[model samples]
Target: MNSKKTSQTEHPPGRSSTPAAWGALAVMASLLAAWIFFESLACGALHAGLTCASWMRGDQLSVGKLTYEGNGIFRANDVEFVFGTTGHRSSWKSERMEIHPLHLVGMLIRGKYQSFRLIRELKVGKSKLLVDRRGAGDGDRGEASLPWSESFMNPANFFPSSIEGGPIDVVVIGDAYRLSLSGLKLLLPDRWAGKVAFDEAQLDMGTWHGTFSHGAAVAGWDGTSLRLENLNLGKETALHEVTLALRDGRADFGIRGTIGKALIRGDGAFGSPGDPNALELTLVGENLQLGPLAELLGQDRRASGTVGQARFTFRGEPDNPLEADSSLRLVANNFRWDGRGWDSLRLAATLTGRKLTVSELSLQQEENILTGKGLVNLTRDWHEALKSPFTAAFSATLDDAGALASLAGPQFATLSGGLAMEGEVRGAENKATGYANLQGVGMKIHGLPVDWMKGNLLFEGDHVVLSHLDAWCGQDNISMEGSVQNSQPHAYKASAQIDVHNLTKRLGQLGIKTATTIGAGAVKCSWQGEGTREAHSGSFQARVTEWISKWTATGMSGSFDGSYAPGQLRLTKAEFLQDELKLSLKLNASARTLEVTDINATRGEKEAPLVQGSIALPLDAMDVWESGDVLRTIDTSGPFAINLALRGIKAEEIEELLGQKVRLTGALEGTISANGSLENPEIHGGLKIGNFVSLAGEAPADLNLTIDAAHGEFKGSLSEAIGQTPLLQMELEAPLRVVKE
Candidate 1:
């Protein structure tokens, strides 16, 4: 009753005040004060970050300059927050972030979010932020948005709405490639799923770098597919519109682009867009220019032509392309390497690891073609490959040598023939071995048709053998068989027959007509060569029958046996035989000296000497007549001799060789000897010219001379009188080496 009286205050409508009402008012006042204090704290700088460890449970949520605008508008500057809930570190921060004005309270009060822009940085599993790209045509389109990071939205809801600040670098492969993106903006319109647009994107790999500008794409709602617009990959490579779909951590993509000067279309599947490790692809190329591409690879600068068509498939890691398992088929049009050209080229091959298996290979130039199939080491140098051992069936044909004028010479420009070779080739390099069945049909040389030409060509080790080879022109034919060794002690053997009539005919056909008279005849020859590193030996035998010419004796037989070393040569025997004339010679020579002995020319079978001579020459004597030191050969290689004897030789025989009528008869005998250095030599020799006749026909032109030198003094006198005045006389007590300059 007392409390009622004391609390007899005014009440709105007959209501009594109680202790509970006062307590409620006190609690309300306390709460108002606390709310004001918390708001003040929220708007202030908190460099230490507000650690909500107990309830909200998070790392440092640092904030700066948190400002509150009336009407539920709020902004946070320099704020950072992280959510490590997906068993992965995912964090985001911004220098200036705009909280969703409409749903800020709902996001804080109920845990539902619309969007906010953390335009600075984001990280997830060593990767950068994801962007939600929305179409620009959408009426509601403004900026991109990102998803709220939670326990479930590892990457799905992590797409950011907008990206600012610096570029976001995303490493596609470890040290292999780096992709960078800038100015990313994403939005969600009403109808279509979403879209993407990039201000710039850069890709770097090894020595190559590519930049794409103003790229755009139409993306599916679930972030699983994208259709990109045209984008140029620098100026070297480019790509057009294509669709990329992702499923089960793999992306299937198809695009048309250019590689080097080639137009390429391809479709493939790879590990993932974020990080691709393995791939399976199929690519087709058309009109692929070769020269520019070859230059890019730093190969033959002269390479040219085009690959008409190519198809290939590869399945393996992209890092090691050559190690991939692949199959290829290529057709090249008018392919050329260096200066050599081919009308077309075709190749079908498969590669596994380092082995390249060829199913077919063909090269064609006009009617000439070469075809073969074999295996090769794909990783080996091409030069080494050419020198490697391999087995293959090869077929080659040569038609119309005119097409190869640069190689065969201009004389063969009009040559028309078909030569075919088919065989199995094995081994290579020093031990190369191969064989071919060679055939020639309708062969013509400079419009002169050949009756026949057939042969078998084979090679084993270092020797090349030509067996059962024969050539015929008109009524003339020659059988030939020879072997040529290519080793250190190289050697060769050859045999052939020469028909003068045919030879003259062939020469006449070559536009080189000669007026000199010649007799019909045949010459047979056999020659061989064998050698060692320091010495070489060779022999030749020739027989001429029914042969006669105005300048040469008729029916001559000759034999030569010789050997040569580094700087030395020896003619063991050299002899020639004509109807009634014979000549024999023996010689030895070195770099600095020459010696001839046993030299004689005889007539008749009785072997009567018509002329004989022995001469010695110290070649080093030339050194004194030249530059520098005047050390004559005689000063070094001493003791040499020279002698000559001429007997009963008619000048008419020599006149026939001159081919000019200088009426003369008889022969002259002469001798020469050296007794000192080349600079000053003691001379003891004589010449008998009285036996000869002069053109003046004056008394048969009797003339002779005598010479002698002693103590550097020279004396000579005419043996015959020149019209009663001793034809010529000379005497000198002074050294002949001295001259009045």
Candidate 2:
């Protein structure tokens, strides 16, 4: 062969003189040598020891090291693979490789076939896996590759596939318990970072059984320079606690502990690293400790009650302070806050917000329920917070007895009637310097037994004014309007006008039995006074017109002036109860006493038989005195008579009408005393009837006779006088009683 190669080399065939057979022989010789050298390298002992290789016909070539542990089991090391380089052109590489011992055991157990496990620590290098049509014969055929494979040359196809029946489990081990991977380069669509993987990872399933301590060791992903601690996960639980620190745009984390069972999920983003300008955080968990959360925010957790199943989302931008807004909403079945005893009675307000429109707000504690709805604008400035009053029109109804009894301590029991109020408060001050306007406000004080009133009331400048106040008591209707200024704290002034028709019914409703009728009248009266708790004094006057009563006067008209100072009402005139009696009387010791004075009265006809009398009265008789038109007390001595003197009067005419001498003469003093009924009181005195004649048509003689008898007794005999024949009848007695006719 050497001599043939030399001859061919020395005389290369010229293009025109070369024979086709010689050229073919020379080419065949060169091909045989190249094939021999390639076969030697493949079969050599050193080459077999150094190179690990596997191949599939017309498809792939894999090269690595085989580790033989004296028990007939083999493992691959530092594997490199290629697929279809001459035909398909695919390739792959790995830093290390592994084969399972169970594969060899399966071969020993079942002797019919070979069994093996393939394990590998993968480290992919830069490669362009491709498919080319030029590799196929017959004018280039089609190529086939996987969907994700770059081309047919992609060496991932060189990965070992299972035999028709293979070992079930594959075990892999590496330098570390879990081989953490980094610095991987992968090309993916859409500029997304490709997934990274860990190799030969070990899992211990026993850490899921027990409870995690409050502050306990948990599992996490760890790195050389960074660590994420306490990453625990399981079916319904996760204990994945992670804290990330970033400085100057560099952030890192690594595993510090073994992973356990709870699925803890949390995400946070902070800007500016050490000096953040903004922060956003989200957390979701169950049975989270609110105390720790409040402590993280520098708040007192004990001030608020515990909550359940919290999902929190927060975003804050410290850089743009002016345009910042925040909102919070919490839902819980029940929550309570402690009131620090004596401050505000442990109150809670629902649906409070800053710059948010609230549909409803309910405040409740103990037996109180207060609800409101409107817009609220919260501000940091306290003055503005108070002054920026919300426009909330509200109606409140409260149980009067329950509300009052709550504040009244133990003084009273069970009240009735609910108090309802509707009003609007504007520009309310924090220190109570504000006023509210009340419209269509009414209150009914039920169970008050006396009167029920309904009216409009207003509150202004610390005063309460009632307008159109209509109160009804039984059948009487009383309408009143008044204002009470500063009516609280024991200092106030009130004035009202009260009108009532059929005042008798009103008095009866008030449990007063007054035998008088205050026919339709309005008592327009006002009083002003100042006093402390000890005493009160004021003056009032009322014009009483046509005040008729059965016991006193009919159609009486007068004005009564009175001054009241504490328990006394002093009346200046009691004249209307007595008609022209001209007597001063005082109501002392529940009895009427008269100051002594002259009294005159006239009754009956003015011409035929008019009666007049002047009498002195005593105060005692006026006590029980009763009369239709007048009341007076008189002293009546013997014979129930009144003494008087008369002249130029017809005694016989008065006696003829009176049936007797109506006047009596005193026996010892010769004074006339009248003793008769008030209609025709008889006039009596020592006097003689002067006989002239009847003044019918004839002139007559004028004669007079005198009588002398003691003790108002008259002795006279005038049977004949003047020119009459026997005009005087004989009077023969020691004491002659004259009966004039």
Candidate 3:
């Protein structure tokens, strides 16, 4: 070195030495290292600060390295982040992440969040999450970075606590779930006790991905508990005064909230090794709607009703609900389900092991009120409780039994009554035994008014027995017994004893008017029927003695037997008797017509013919007779051949048959022949009366009457004479019309 100094051709100190050359190179390298260090520092610092100030006020993150890629571009790898109020740490590891830092400046002024298309591994709690690419949607999606390195160089950047941001995608995790948010927006409070509101973000799991909401909430953490004031859950629910304490793998929570317009409150504890569901919940509502509440429970209940209140308590394993201990008390008003509805309901029950005990149950529906208490066995699943083996007792009262018209078809529309009943049921699901006794007063069925009706029924499965049934309607009374066995296709038998006093009077009470009354007496009836669910057939018989009619003397008698089906009815036998008068009739009828198979009538001990032969009635005159309108026009389907032997006819009997009270005595003998259709009838009859006796004395006279109809004209002559002397004579004729009206 000393020799070099003297040489005068100096190269600067250490410029030629090997170590000096190294030193110069070191300085240049140092300068380059310093530049890189500052760049990284700026990038990291500005990132954390901007994140906390703009997106999440409490956000903190550590990035492996953020490198600048020119044109305001930046990249990062292996990012670890802590977001929102949760202190839980999550990490993102990837080869590279592209971003344009300066773009965030403009976005920061727009007050919106962007959707992120997550394509790689996102670890949340121990669950591996992958955001569905297609689900991310292409709208409002973008990514930008905070030019941290550039901002670090500018002192102005350090002073900005916050800057409004547009919808920009940033790699940030949700507090509860791992979600890829879209249009995310957050309004964080400056103070720890202030409120925060956010919405229009997407939801994946524990992540904040959802739609827009204007709900506001203030949350505070006091050591072990967190409470939220004024928090909205979804579009229809809001929570108030909610507190949750989570510690040692256990969470204790309480909540007061509203679902739609219904108020709800509950408290519970969950987690740990023992309890699957440990809670006590009470919901008290007045006229609360059921549709929205049902949606919250993931059920479709298209019904109308008000939920009065419900209390539920449970503690046990979820896998074996029968083995769990639970209690429930449900009360509802105007609750409806399955095309039926109830006025009000109250139920209380408790479960212990495999048994469920019902302490109280009361239900009011329509015009009926029912009460029951029972106990039943249950299997592992709670659903089996419905069809399980059990014993139960129930009682019911009907304020207006007719209001339950749907159960009995259209007949109830004309019926009105109330019933009181009590019953006991025992056995398994498919095979059961039950007994019930019912009594009703002021009952009516199909216009048949009854003073009272009482019956007792015993049933074993599908078999039913009507032990005894009694009906009393003023002067009419009936007693019956019946049984129905089997399922859909049932076999049934019934018998009844009826007593009638003053039948015409009873008919009037029922708003019925009949053209004629054949008889009124004790009637015995029985029938055996067998059919499927849709159709039925049965045979019935009625016998009566001592009959009377409005147009005849009091002494009368009759018997009637018939078979009936849905479409047809046949009178097997019908006999009528009034004094010495006797009549028999057999007929078959359909919906529109009646065909008389046989008909014969006679009078006196000699059985002289009064009328004979049958008539085919189309659109029969039965309605005319029922309405007491004898003059009503009628039509017949076929020609008729009939004979009337007017013999042994007394004047008193004739007067009675004609609905008169004339007092006279005589015998008349006649021969009458009739032919042709009812629309154009022909009749030729002759009658002679001798030994006629009046109230005063016997008349020495013989009366002769003749009737003839032919050629569209009718002629009749009446003549009376005393011995050979003529007392009176008369002749009458009338023109006939070919068409009947």
Candidate 4:
């Protein structure tokens, strides 16, 4: 065999070798060529697949045989690849084959022309890729990775348009739900010197669907960064549903909870990345629970109503810090609040930086209304915020009839008037102060009318100051100045002065009537008091120039001191009723008792012997009536002056005082007492008495007091020639009477 091999190798031309030698040479050459071709095909298939099947399970890959066409072209059919990166694991499969002309040409040329370009497109039918925790190498539980940041694979030089009729579909399984991508396109950057476009895409994850059309996105190496445009997302969940559209703005997603149901939405750019400080954006459909907001913000919704709608706007620099300006407007109807029901209510407010400003606030209940406009600054810098003072001014007007009717109690229902108030509130840190100018403060009590009052009110700490107060009611004007400490609804100590003009008119307004305007007098009074929530206690001292009108039956003036403590009122001073009567009366309001001492009265003139008396009066027996008619008409142009009847009196007294037996038919009456004292008297009946009583120098021994009576009846007087002896010291007793008949 050795000699034959040598002989066949050395043969030159037309030399036939032995059959055995020829057979051995041909077999060896065929074996070498077959090995080379098989190796090339294997290398081409591996390079095209871009996966190492040696490390994968047999079931994970379904790569078929590789084949070589003409012109250095190689193809593989029914290939599948499995891989993982960081938090992701995936598998991809295709039914058809893919061939890389570049790889085939390079292998055929044997590295000769190292820089060569080949086919620009490749495709496969029915491609599928999956990403799950089991394939991601992190066990089979917990969250894998962010879906947008997951690792994915694409063909090296395959443009999106060449990959069949449309984009390949991709499916992903995540912690929340299964995600699907449809009509996806691969994009390559200009820096990569590749021509590819990701024109349209759609993502479906649970109830959320995101679609991007007419846009392109490029994914960097390692998939760390992705740039996309013309994106839109729509979500529907249990709490709230939203649709987001973006163009020419960055997309940043920071979501927690399920895929579509997120408690917060933080997607969108903060301006350009290089100029993040100039970011401006708007957030919508952010549902904020009122109860949670109140709890988290230290705000209470305890006022007797409901809070309707609320919204906020946020704006700021992204790199340094952030701030927001927020506004909210609320509407409520028939809102019951502050002890009353309100109608037509609206409140609008805004918060800018650390300041809360109320643009318009109004409330209306029936005819009573309140309006407020103000700002509350909560900035930390004291000096800067203090310069503005967190101030507010409010004006309120109450329709007297409606307001009083709403209160309904005796103290308020009968009141009728209007009140207007304007005020400013200022504050800084822990201290707050305020000042207000008040006008048109009026009150109508028990049908008495008071008109426009002017005053200045101030508040500092817990003290309230009332200064330069001037008021008018009927014919009387009053001025007051005072300060109250620890002033609330009832707990306070106030010292004030009250002055009056035309005292009679003031009394008449209180339902007291007399004959003369000369009853006018100036009164100086001081009051100091403290009160509990239910009651008040105080002491008052008053000095009046004249207590009674001179044109009436009596004229007197005096100073009096009184104290009212809870249910009790006591008067201590010198008090006189008639010009002919003098007495020191002590009144105990709680006991309802009156004690008259040192009572003396003279009936005759000062030049003659006067008739005097000592008597006790019972205050409980007195009858007091409110005067209904303030206008007392007098015929100054007539011959005889007409006398009006006293409101609290009787007809019988008129006849006796006039020394006439007269019967009265009118409604007016004079008060009289059986005790023979004017202090406690009753109006037995109504009458108009107009007559003159003449007094003699002295009492006669018989005291023959003859009197003619008419118009009204009288009893218990001198009668029928009957008389008492020792008249100077005897009680006058008789029954000479006049009857209305």
Candidate 5:
């Protein structure tokens, strides 16, 4: 009753909570909770979705185990993926893999306009792969990222597009994927093929797309061959089409291309892929450019213009490839050899079977031209042809020595002027022999000057013979013939005969003093020898006509004739004539000694006999001819004797031999003999003087002097008295000492 009625007040009526609004709130809350729940289950669902998609595509995947974690992370252990059909399948295996499933969903819902972040890690044995979101995006128009692979697939038939280099991008649009790369390098597998790089590269593939290019390309596959077309390799070459096919036991390849402005075409085939190689090829080039080819040939050369044309048809084994028909002609601007450059070269040659013919070959430089032609026969296997005899005929005409020196090496470098040769040569691998007619003008050979030369050269093995040689030595014209046989083994036989017209200044050139060669004369020289250099058993003879070697002795002349056999030599005649004196000698020699048979001298007329003598050296006591002593080797060694017989000699003539002037006029006669060893002789002789007169005293009737050999004493007596009495008598004793005089 009384309860709290005191505060009774009026209360406005409020609308009660409606079921529809409560239901709306409950629906919104349920939506948010369901979204969170679905997000939590995303990893497992994604894995199931992928499995279902793979199954629909008829692809197979084997996984040892699968796992799911928070934040939509899915993982698998031991997973294998297979692509392609049942007949030709490509497979890959992975030890472990991790993927973010939510990221894939985000990419799907964003409709490709927004960037989807992806993070993945895959491991296979020793190789690994990591993917980051930094480089994978919308073509080249957005930020780019690349996946990192730790290892490469074997055979490398396909490669994934990468963006680790300069600002490259990749994107997926519609049913295709595209990649853009700039300044990229791709490795080539061949050792000598080099590498292929590009300034900019682009690829877009839906299924099996094959068209691609840079400067060169493997364009597409047609039937059984790979076709490469429309390639521009710098400014040097342009290729139209190239095809390569390998099938069964045959391989075929061809090229239809252009280099510079030249058109080139070739086709090659290889039959039988076994031990021996067999191939047939036909190559034709028109207006082939030489400028670009010079770099590939050598760096020491430079060239320009074009070779006229070349045709080569070859069908043979590798060892005999040159057995086909081939010809080439070229004109080069600058040709170089041994670091020396020359100007302009024209070359042309043809080969057929074992015959090689050079039609035109010449070099022109510095106002010099060298032209040559040759025909050669190579009739055996390549190596056997080198060792066997080959026939060749060649001729060369040189306009200048410098050009010949360049081609023939340094031996001819010092020579100047021109040379010409015509020869037929036969050769083995290590030796060559030939016959040639050589002619030259204004040449210097071995530092000996010649104005002109002509010779016939004959060669056999290591020997050369110069026959009928006409050359100029100084001002003298010399005609000579010579030959050397067996020169290499050093037991040589040589002979030469020279006829010289003038010998005065020519002798000076041979190192004889001008004063020694005081007169001009003609000389005839002949020599014949057959021996080694160490010991020679030969002889030479020189004869000079009208010889005058001194001014004071006007009529001086000499003649010598000598012969040398095996161990013996004979000087048959040696005579010298000067004024009123005549001397003659004959000598014989053994291996180690010499013997003078007789030495005779006569002054004045033979009838008048102012002085005449016969001198003899008799050594007949010992037999020691093998000793190295001239007297002992040629004759007996002990008890040498000298005998002299003289008549009609004046005292003044005998005083001339003693270097004294005598005023006595006398006719002397003597018979002298000395006998002993050469070092000591016993004298037994006597001299008689008759009708002697001197300016200082009166004439004596006769005087006699006798030498006693046993007593070593001399006795003098006046045979006829002057003024009715014997004028003088004397006895003297003196020891005799003998010495070499």
Candidate 6:
């Protein structure tokens, strides 16, 4: 009866009975409350569990807001996670983090996750990152997705080494990680970059990918090892593969790249970027183009060459970096630099903390070689280094000085002889002190012929001291000692002691006409001159010895004390000594004329006749320096005079001049005065012979003569006679004629 009645009480589909609907509604409501309660409890439990785990993990976890949604989903707003000790902690913040309950539970229960994802947009300092993990296999094999943008790639946020700029993807596969970029632009700081060493180096890649493997033993990365593949930097610079390894406070890297037309192979290692203990490093490059390298260094000049092999090594620690050990070597072909070039170059150098040593530095071309070496210091600033204190020793040997014509200028273009020099230098570059000894054979300087030359030179600042110089000047040996100063404009002081052998031959070689055929002499001179090259003035002193010219032998000893000031030169003392002749003169000169102030001459002893006079000589008369004439050119414009006094004379001496035997015994006394042009003389004087005798088949005769040169008349009378033809008289009148020899 009850079953029949329940079957008969069926309600329409759209409408239900009040009692049945009420009961169903109550059951649904209860289920909803239970779902809500479970969800809330799950969210709360998750929050509490993570908080407790954070404490155990030495992490500080904070959440701004926590909420739960349908289907076992939970979200946290403004979540923060801090790891590490308080003293050195790192923190990460997330705008929002989402968790799927079922997936989390599965990961926990399985112990090893096949797949799991924790999605968040995280930030560290000023950078933001999107991190996700797809799967984890016992914490060893995992697939992680870490995408970053420009705002998320900052060097300071990570390690001390620098990096910047990226829209990159970091992917994980098993125990390895990769960074992939379609177009990457990167800038790295110096001291840590692989191929380029600069304050900042830039690398542009159209597409690049890198991978690295890490171990659990390391806190951040197992070891500093980065492998790059498929890197296209630019048209001029590209690399197929590169590997960088940093371990044990050191870095090592290798690269195979292309720079312009040259294939580049490079390997290098150095200490940690900022390690306190000195920086020790070694770098080697093979087949590297210099042009592109110069461009990379921001230099204006372009170079063209390929370095066959180059090596650089550094050692030792420096407290101030000024005393660091460094060295460099280069082997290159067709090397060009600074508008000058060389065919092949090989250089090796070493720099200790205190000094620099150049073991080998040379340039080779066919049969010519130029070698050089020196010592110097290195400083942080080039200018400071150039001005710092230093001592250096250098030696150069050249097969042909013409090979260095570019450096020696056009004046030395014709230099074609072997040259060698050894020198030592001390002090700074601008004001240095040094000594150099140069030797040359069969050489010519500025068209001055030299058979063999040797010079010892010392220099200080702008002052040069030529201590000793001996050279063959046109088959003549000349030795000179002098000093020259160039500290001021046109202000020079020079002193020289010059000794010449075979002066006549040397002068002839110089196109000079000389009266002397053979001569040897020494001149000691000192001059202090100032002004332009065209004109100069100063004090001058000269001492001459053993000077013999023409048929006259004079200047066995001579002295000249003179001074040139302004436009005038004054000779206060000029004297010469001969066998029995002595001459002294004083003179003054200007641009117009030379005035002879005083002249005195003596023969034999002090009792001999003395002559003195003055002459004004035109400056043009002293053109010996220009005409190269050894003979004196004395053409005077003003009045000229000669005074002569004669005492006793021997007959044998008269015969010596006349070249004929004369029978004469007499004492001659006369005073002669002449004043006129040197070419023609006007004489007014008288001669008297006492006890004179002429042997012409006759007896002796006393003769008296009267001469009036202006009137061209002479009167002579023989007063005493011992034989026939005594008391003879003669008078003559004739035109004056003077002969010059």
- State the C-alpha lDDT per candidate: 0.59, 0.37, 0.62, 0.47, 0.55, 0.56
How many clashing residue pairs appear in each of the predictions shown? 12, 46, 18, 20, 3, 0
Q: What is the C-alpha lDDT profile of model 1 across 511-586, one tens digit per residue?
A: 5453344432455555455554456556555445544544454344556566655666677787766656677888
Q: Quick one: ranking by TM-score, best first? A: 1, 3, 6, 5, 4, 2
lDDT of 6 by residue, 534-553 (tens): 56766777777776553233
Q: For residues 618-675, what per-residue lDDT tens digits would candidate 5 score against the true structure?
A: 4321122212133433333345455666575666656544334667766678777766
| Residue 715 displacement in candidate 5 (angstroms) | 23
Q: Looking at model 6, how many pairs of residues clash?
A: 0
**CA-RMSD of model 5:** 20.0
The deviation in Å at residue 428 for candidate 3 is 4.7
lDDT of model 5 at position 243: 71
* Better model by TM-score: candidate 2 vs candidate 4: 4
Model 6 worst lDDT run, 10 consecutive residues: 214-223
lDDT of 6: 0.56
- Per-model RMSD to reference: 11.9, 32.2, 12.8, 19.5, 20.0, 17.4
Residue runs of model 5 more than 4 Å from their true location after superposition: 1-353, 363-370, 379-391, 396-406, 409-415, 423-435, 457-467, 473-475, 482-496, 501-522, 529-539, 545-557, 560-741
lDDT of model number 5:
0.55
Model 1 residue 336 distance off true place after TM-score fit, in angstroms = 6.0
Per-model TM-score, in order, reads 0.57, 0.26, 0.55, 0.36, 0.41, 0.42
| 1 versus 6: better TM-score goes to | 1
